[model samples]
Target: MPLIPMKQTVTRIRTEGNEWDGTKTEIRTPMKCAINEGTKLVRSMSGSAGVQGTTSSEAVSSAQIYFDKLADIRLTDVLEYTNELGITRRYPPLTIEIKRLNGKPILTVVSV
Candidate 1:
């Protein structure tokens, strides 16, 4: 027997091409997803250095969200997270890394 898990409903927004007037179009779908977040320190290049080419070390500690769903998510899509507070958060587009578990998609979104 296959194990059945509970599901959560989330709004899926995607770019659906442009209109004849040269305007962007979007497609929204209501689906089930699981969301989680974590924090860690990341190191990235700041800017161009001098002729010496000596770069400074900087550590940024920030939290990132990991959203899991059975649908395909795009980099240009915005995730709407719903909470009990009746406040809907519109998440900006970020680099999405996807992994599959039991033939389901798990999207890991990070802040840029």
Candidate 2:
């Protein structure tokens, strides 16, 4: 079984080495992924007010990308997604997790 019936081919862009040392290297790899774009609620609580507590939530752009279990992805890596119309968007991974889906392991990445 597959978690997604359809997947898109995207480019994973990862940079290695140190910028200060002029050893920066960029690696690009093709990856099959399922991308979901939506809004994520960011919550915050303030306790500066005396005898009062304030909680706030802000809607932010978010994307969830699922990759193969063996995908070499990192938080510092950026994903380049090209739509069917040839429009491209780049997103830096904010979180990465390995989880089981449909009785198989997969890599889940969140970008904001």
lDDT of each: 0.56, 0.76
Model 1 TM: 0.51
RMSD (CA, Å), each prediction: 6.5, 4.5
TM-score winner among the candidates? 2
What is the TM-score of candidate 2?
A: 0.65
Worst 10 residues of 1 by lDDT: 1-10
Cα lDDT tens digits, model 2, 27-86, are 999988888776678888786746546478898876788776646787788889887778
C-alpha TM-scores of all predictions: 0.51, 0.65
Question: Where does candidate 2 stray beyond 4 Å?
Answer: 39-60, 101-104, 107-109
**lDDT by residue for model 1 (1-112), tens:** 1123325456778877677767778788875544543335555454555444434555543324445443466767776767656767777646666556777754544442
Q: Which candidate's lDDT is highest?
A: 2
| Candidate 1 segments exceeding 4 Å error | 1-6, 19-23, 37-70, 100-112
